[model samples]
Target: MNKPMFGIDFGTTNTRIAFYDGETVELVKIRNPDSGVDVANIPTQAGFDEKNGNWHFGFDAEGFKQPKDSMKWMLLRDYPVEEISGTESKELVTLFFHHLKAVVAEARADEYEGQELSHAVLSIPVTFSLEERRALCESVEAAGIVVEQIYYEPVSALYAALRENFRQMPIDENLSGRIAVFDWGGGTLDIAIATIRNGFLYILKRDTLLRGGKDFDQIIVEKAMQDLKSKYNRHLDSYIETAYHQKAADLKKTAERIKISLQNRDNFALNYPRFIPKGAVNPPVEEDINLNFPVLKENLRNWIGKDIEQGIELLKECICQTGIPLDDIGLATRCIILAGGTSNLSLIEERLLEEFGTLKFGPLEKIERVPPIETYSSEPRRFFSSDKFGREDDASVATAVGNALLAADGGIPTFTCDIGLIVLSPTGQPYPKRIFQEGSPLPIDKPIIRQLPIINRGQEVISIQIYFQSIGYIKGEFEIHVDVKEHTVEISFHVDRYRILRVSGTGKNYPKRTQQSQDAIMDFPIAFRLPEKLKT
Candidate 1:
């Protein structure tokens, strides 16, 4: 058999993996040893045990009896060690990946007993910075896995949705048109607008909203705590910020469960015994507190309504950024595909239907012959599908499944963030001067050349600082040992398919002393991330 290649969707709240061959894709299911039931994904969480000095992950971490070490979204930050103690965030992230690998190995021992699960295609958010991307690669490598490629989250989902829903139609036949992907996951809502032609997916615009299903869960948790205090006249705040104890862990778990149940039901009763043990809070509690919080779907909608509205606004902004006229877009759009777990919400689906027209699922419904479009037709029609993939919770696995197909056929990934250099203004303030814009295909063909005036002719060293979106900057210096007669240095920047930047510099004109051009090349492995404040 060919060497097994896995596709990993390393999400903020949950992680999933899949194996794909040239013809088919198989999601690698994890059989819980404790429950003896199979699950499609694991939570992106970790815990450090102080007593045994051992680390636990996923379900194990959630069930750890000791005080819970909250290490959920630390991987998203450049310097993630601020709140964490006992070990650095990188170590914990690596350990989580290691545990993930071990679990997969144990679950699939029958098929992949001797084969090494070394290679993988990983998916990441567009907001990841250069440092964050490097850290992720290092952690994955430390966990004994090599990253074959990194794909943007929304793009992978779009690709998967397109292929899965439109499998019968040839690309050139009826698949070419404008497409939008609304990927609402646990931690982020990613929207992408692209045009497909001749089987190639070209991303025209993309945006991210820094809120998602997790935020809804948090809102419910806070409300539940407030209700507990109101009815019992006792504070149930578990002091999660300073002391992440078992009570806080259990409370969060209960809140998450409540959120899931309320998705399909009209209401849910959150009952937990001993929610807060005696003396767990300040102004010492006299006795244990039990929570019996009654929640309604209307209450949930009211709580998260503004957040959901903001998400719709973001989608509008993404469509506008595509530079396509609304009328033309409505005419040309093939489908507005939905991916990620949050897309399963009825509220979101209803909002999409109200915003657009009625949506129709092409794969499920029989395709009938229709009249060809007239170029000047002005009638508004539905562009997005009402539902996707005809499965209960398929949105959760769309990205991983798409990534698995990409690993098999080798999908082309676009550069998701801006890459630029830090230039000084007349006031001596530094700012980014972008050379490579986002939404372009990877491995830029042409090099960007710039000429800089030599500040100090006496020093033969030239220093340059490159900025990656809003993340931070990295500095590189090139020394050209030549005559100082030439007052300017020429620098060229080229990015390869691996996202490695090759920067070369040389004296513009040869000095009469040597009459030779000296060149210095510096290779920097670079990746990009986006800013939290969406650009207007």
Candidate 2:
């Protein structure tokens, strides 16, 4: 995507913006010329006026705290104009972009010698539904920028972070394999596996679970608040400032802090300066508040990452069903690539190594780490300036960075994904209806499909629904749909050497071919989700 691509990361707690410069991916932020204050990735907190619904975003919204107004949380999905909490998502997005546009306009005049802008890209969560994706496209249009394409956050990271630094991963014929990409973020933990085949990228399998840093924070806060109320033996609701809301907010902050610190330090602290009493406005029982949690080996083993044990197990099941020994994974393809927000965890590498057992699968002899993955902005500013970056630390910002890279890059690779629907014909195919075989190298050979059985003169115009399914991931749970008459279905699929599908059928339909590819309508680009068949 030449002509300058832009990518925006609209997150729950923070937002980031960047553009691909055709060569490099850089984080865009509030960089001052004289003072050299680089405050990028401002917080997502927004302030809304009570009388009117006008909003102030980032620092301006955070700095001005009034009792009459409330801080609004940004909705992070791709759905076309939808609802969040109680607010209209489109309205909220409009306000957010309004603030972002002002910031960009200021930057356009100040930074780039006042060149008028046109194109941009925005990052979206893997869990975003088709509706959500549609809404996001509308919101982008509302923001007055042309969005060329949208990439899943996890895959985008490679284009931005990995490709930006280490471009070499032995592209020769020797090393080829599959990699499990596990990403844990603020609101969700997504796991996906992809393989690069014949210099192309294909997602074999993937899934997203809704439990991340934000969920962890809510857990700690809810638990702490209950404990405090039980111990105090009085109502603390009166002290919403420091007692009710503040604690949850602070606990969320602490939860985030620990999430990062655990990457380096096995232990970190929870800071709370004030302890408000029951029914008292300023009555304080305070000290240098801190609670140290040593996220040691055992602690992490018991931490949220452990929640993904089932997910990993499911992945293993997928791998096992393929009958291809773990050893053959690398030999099956090229090399496994890891990209995502939560992948920053040292435990990630540690855990994968543990799972790989002897570490040599199939013809795969050795695993390699290209370059240390890093985020665009570590300490995202919220209604304020930061003293420094990369020091304060942020981990979940990788997906947005990847989105930026995809936005800048000219072309995205072909995929291993497909869509499925049942064609209710009088009889199933006598042969294996193998327009695409399982695990054949991607950019599936679109066979010139003719001779489709439809009883025309025999009796009446007979129509059949082509059954779409994903193979080898699970025993048999395909996303089913009906392919009506006159609707042509186009398929995207690739199975591995063991006939195990990493990604599966995308059922696209078109009323007429019109020189375009057969199935252009009913396009269902399934999110890269890994069912049980392909895990390990």
Candidate 3:
């Protein structure tokens, strides 16, 4: 019998995994072996135990006295970490996946006893580059699970939403509309504009911000510190500050809890022991931090409100770029899909509704209510109809569930490229040319070939370097010794579903370019260009 396939949403704040057992799709619950607490999502956190010199993950790592290292979106960027090495980050991610595999094994022990969990479909943010995707696949593969395919996060959510809400809407042979997915999570906020034509989702534009719920938490923490200083007329001692800095993981958890608790309530109290020092006292003092909804709301608006406005503006730009009229957008667009844990905040929904004016899912008053995590299910019908629209936790794991569904159904129709492809000129200077523009459909079966003439007579070798306009690094290059008689060389580029670039070159005199072709497999890099777009 074939092994069951799993879908994983490796999110910034939390990670979720679901399995497809031929007939039914179920969200796997990962329980902390030490705490015995069943959690639908695991925190994407890891730490090194000082005493044992061993690495821990998820809840175990979060509970450590020392600060936990979070690799969240680090894989997407080339930023070097002073403390944690790249290998360590990969190992941590691998350990987390190993834990997920164990959980799935334990859950299916009865029906598929002693069966090894293998194949999986992973979901990534729309803005993830080819390099980031490859790094993620490598990490998961290191954990012993074979990654079968990768789906974009918003695309997966769209699939789940369409599957569940299909019965509620009109079933037409030609169903076409736009869906603006506002996915704001812990470490990143990605606003994507996609169109559904003939039952397939195509991304028109995607704008990403390297800011999200974590930024909100930081704002809250800073605000709380300021408030405490003003109220108590006391500052945190250097020692206390150092200690709290070391416990960033715990402090962040506290801030996040307060933020969530204040979602529905008017006020929430954030209390911490030994938070500040009382005038030369050897021992630090505790603080009872009370933050009202209005004050918290105002603070959020004052700090991150500009970012929210920018997000909405980007949405409008996407609509404009897609040639969708502003007035018709409300009707032409099926719904404004909100996914990711940060979307739970009423402010985000309010801002979007204020701008767009039409949300297919429902109104703010109707969809803002937070549902208990236990109410979540992997079944499509039960998943959407369990509540009026859907559960609050749905935003957290919808991507994972949808990925499992796509994997089971042999995946969906969605493009992968996000930036224009370019190559270096023969003059040794980097000259940009668009081989394939962003938002193009994936699995390009036909190769894009370009012919370069050997103008320099008696040149021993001809070298071709490929580069992506967005990604600064050289993707791949090949060199062929000049056959004095040959006039031109043919360079062909083929990008697969996984965004892996396959470049091959053939000379008229040299029929055997197989070895050179094998050496041209390189993951293309995507450039960071949101700020550049905003500036323009």
Candidate 4:
């Protein structure tokens, strides 16, 4: 029997995994040791107990008295990190992955007991560079999980949405059209435009913004701090800056609660008895914080309104890149799927509905204001009784679900971005010629061949400049040299199922003029991208 290949969505705020064994796609629910609850997701966090020298991860780590270390991005970016939780950042990431592997093993113990846990189809943000992807893959592999492939998060999310809503299996040839996915998660906002034609999903354009749900939470926290200072004339900033770190963390949690509550109600009372620990403040300075403030939906809108507007503009740009007119988006778009935790915000949904009208796939939910949360209770309680937050049972899991479908051979992926060459003329002018356009199905059997004349006589070297999406080019264009009086060079390009680009080049007259073969082959991941240094 083949080892099961799991689909992993290593998100910025939370991580989720699924498994597909050709028969069924199982969304793996991780057991949180701290809560003793089986959850479909866990925060992407790591913490170390300084007192006992024990490590914690996910919900367990979130409950740590000490601040949880959220530095996976630092490792992914190859940032120069000195230390995290007394260990290197990369080591911490590997440790987190190790914990994930263990939990996954436990979750599947009934069926795959003692089976080696390996092989994953991981999904990543489209903006992640080759180096960043490699770093993430290496970290996961260090935890003994081999990465079989890395797919774009938007593509995975779209596939999942399609399966969930349309019940349209990927092989169904009747369904085809333009669709957009807005994935606003905790760390970033990813917008993608894709088209389905002839049973293949082709990503047309994808863009991302650094702002997301976490930023919205920060905005609320800042507003609360301002309101507290204005109303009570008491400040916790000094204490937060000093040794009272827990005060800040707890306040941030309160802000998050307020944000979620305000999503369902017009106003929510932020009442926390002894909000700040008694000893944190000195006598004659201030009393123990019994914070009481009312946060309105208008306030929440005012706080995150601009950011939401910016995200919508970014989404518009993504749609425009697909040659879809902004005015006719509602008519042209078959569906606009909203994924990610932040997509639950009413303001975002309102703005999208206003812009695109009623979507063809589903009706937009009207924002219904309800009574605020009961502040009369003595202890703190969650905004919602059901624990889970966000629309459609949480959109963050879409990527992992779709990745599982792909692993089960339930979807076919097409090239989302274009691959082309920049031809430099004798006059130093550059012209771009596309080899494979967006929407080309993957695993191309025949290679597209191109022959270019040597511009200058006795030109010993030929340079082939390749680019993607017309913005970024692969660094170091293919440089093939010839010495046998060749006047032209022949090049061939093809993309495999894994989206790896294969390039083969040869001097036209090498076989006749020289004994040495001049054939050269180069392989590059289509996902690989670098800032364009030359125009293409």
In the order shown, the candidates' Cα RMSDs to the true structure are 8.6, 9.5, 8.3, 9.0
Worst 10 residues of 4 by lDDT: 376-385
lDDT of 2 by residue, 1-536 (tens): 45455577666556666655655444556653333666555556555454564566676654332222111223343232222224566656666776776776666523333433356666566677645665666766677766555666656654443443344443321124554545565556565565544444455555677665566555555555555555546454455335555445445656655665777776664545445532255455453223333334445546556555654565555444445476565344322334433445566546654665333222334435333223212211110122212433234445555665554443343324333333334454322244433333224223333333332222222222333345322122233232344333333343321112332333234224212222222222322222111122
* Tens digit of per-residue lDDT, candidate 3, span 274-345: 453343345534533333222355555567788788767776777667778877766666556667888767
Ranking by TM-score: 3, 4, 1, 2
Which order, best to worst by lDDT?
4, 1, 3, 2
As a whole number from 0 to 100, the lDDT of residue 303 in candidate 2 is 51
List where candidate 2 sits over 4 angstroms from the true fold.
31-39, 63-87, 107-117, 168-170, 173-175, 233-242, 245-247, 261-305, 308-341, 345-397, 413-454, 457-536
Task: Point out where model 3 deviates above 4 Å.
Answer: 1-4, 32-37, 65-69, 76-87, 109-115, 167-173, 232-237, 276-304, 358-392, 412-481, 487-497, 506-508, 511-536
TM-score attained by model 2 = 0.64
TM-score of 3: 0.74
Task: Tell me the tens digit of each residue's lDDT in model 4 across 208-317.
Answer: 99887767767766666666666645565665344334555456656766776776789987666765666867553456766677889987888788888898889878
lDDT of 1 by residue, 1-536 (tens): 13456778887667887776655556666755555767766777765565786768887876554223233356554343433345667777788888878877776745444545677878777666655676787788888887777777887787676555445443432244557788888888888877643334667677788887777877877787677656755433344232323456566666666777776899998777766566766766687766678889889889988988998888767777767666565445555677787877777767766665533222212223222222211111111122422233367777887666665665545444566665333345555457666655555446778877665454444444565563345544334444656567666777643355666656676644433233333333222221111111
Tally clashing residue pairs in candidate 1. Answer: 1
CA lDDT scores, all candidates in order:
0.62, 0.46, 0.61, 0.63
- Superposed Cα deviation of residue 238, candidate 4 (Å): 2.0
